[model samples]
Target: MRTLETIIIGAGPCGIRTAIILKEAGVDVVVIEGAAPGGKINIAPRVDNYPGYKMISGPDLAAEFFSWLNDAGVEMIGDLVTSLTKEDDLFIVQCEHNTYKAKSVLIASGTKEKKLALPKEDKFFTRGISYCALCDGHFHKGQDVLVIGGGNTALKEAIFMADIAAHIYLIHRRNEFRGSNKYVKELNDLPNTTILTPYIPVELIGGDRLTGVKIQNVETKEERVLDVQGVFPLVGQIPNSTYVKIPGVLDQWGTIPVENKTKKTQVPGLFAGGDILPRDIRQIYLAEVDGKMAAKAILAYLEK
Candidate 1:
């Protein structure tokens, strides 16, 4: 088994940033990512939000990050972390082919994009359907689109769509929205927003790409189809925290329960960063800020 001073369990922006900081501080750190260094960045269309880079493609941004990683002399092991075992106050990281020992672990896996249940969704993804409004919304400007789910993310997406799209059809299975009332009122006030409550998507119709969405009313069982070239799924997100099983600080959803101001998790040496923990805002900038703060806490833990 290889031994290291610290093991970063993700290759996303957060993980890479943390590794850069630790290495610059003269700390021995190795980044272990399940996939490539830029986990979700590989699929992101274009990220215009991340500061310093005015406009950049996902792969381009990822490439730039890898360049910095190289300069920092950070060791990257592109392997999936299956599980973590605590042995004598150290963490044993179990991957597919290798096992690593580290004094501390930081989970920056972030939130995986939520999927649409439609079996055809997999086949049509990136062709017309998208889960990220900030990434794909501009492509459908002045065009009709369908927004599914009723949570805060969904409502916020609908609000975003209303800004550029000519029209939007908001569909939800519940008559009452699952998102906060304040945002729901804002969505309702939009002129182009059409609320289709108590309805759920049944199928996506299109020839080569998504042309429309088929929805049915749960109460009346009535069927209706909305014509559109784009479909956005803005439902809630699921955290990637199943690898570690530390006790006394987890909610039912496996998210680390931490104090609002401090990013301390249940375990002493273990900490979480990015959108993995539950919070009102999960923006890219916020996640990056949280990752930096979490790294500070981790550094503090190592000192004591």
Candidate 2:
């Protein structure tokens, strides 16, 4: 029943940054992470938007962040958090193997990729369908693949697979893309890329493994199937805030609504930031800023 000043529930950009700041301030704080330290950034193939480096890989950036945590003497606990509850102004964090009590808590768990929810999607999980192009693109060399979504992730993955896969079929529910114009232009110029707009995936067609995807045009209600060996669905992200047991703190999407200035949630001593907060843009720097702000806010709250 050891209680600390603060506990962060993630090790991503936001969590890492928040932990560093709190540690430097001499606050008793610990970060809990279930997966790798870098979080979703580890899955990214390339990151060209971060402030410091003009171009760098996601893993590289994450490694640098880990180094900072080490140098700052921030303690990180590796465990999967199951739930969060508050009792008598103290927060209780429940994990599979252990439990922790903290005076304050920060939820920076980030987001997970949204699934198409079509039947057979689970059956072909690793057989052919994948969410990470950098991890599975090599397996589809000289083969055809389907990329579903209309965001930057979909565009980037499509471009990355173009070199390995013989052909890339990118399908989106809308005719217009939600990604940057630069990515759209680059993806269009690729000789092996074909853009299918206004199409929604209706079913995943395969036997033992995925072989193709059945899509329908949103406008015409016409249906067609694309023959491919891989399916990358980068449709969107869903907040990883199920551990938050507090009612009225979560929105319809499960994302926590926080005060823009301080990242404070509806409950006192409970803060949220980074990808868990509803925002149009999701980036490492923005998440870092959220962490810094939340840490500072926590410090101020602790002072009182």
Best candidate (score: lDDT): 2
Instruction: Name model 1 segments beyond 4 Å from true.
Output: 116-199, 203-213, 217-222, 226-232, 260-262
Q: Candidate 2 residues 1-304, lDDT tens each?
A: 7789999999999999999999999999999999889888888877876887988887898898889999999998999999999999899999888999999999999999999898999899889999899888899999999999988888988998999999999999998998999999999999999999899999899899998888999999999889999999999999998888877889998998999989999899999999999898998889999999999999999988
Candidate 1: deviation at residue 162, Å? 14
lDDT of each: 0.79, 0.92
Cα lDDT tens digits, model 1, 1-304, are 7887789888777788788888888778999887767767765555654788886777788888889889999999888888877787898899888999988888887767567778689777887798887678899999898999887667877877899899999988889986789778888898998988899899989878888888999999999889988889866677787777555645787666665444667676776677777775665676667667767777877788
Residue 198 C-alpha lDDT in model 1: 90
Q: Give per-residue lDDT, candidate 1, residue 264.
A: 68
Prediction 2 TM-score vs. true: 0.98
TM-score on alpha carbons, each prediction: 0.71, 0.98
Candidate 1 has its poorest 10 consecutive residues by lDDT at: 254-263
Candidate 1 overall Cα lDDT vs. reference? 0.79
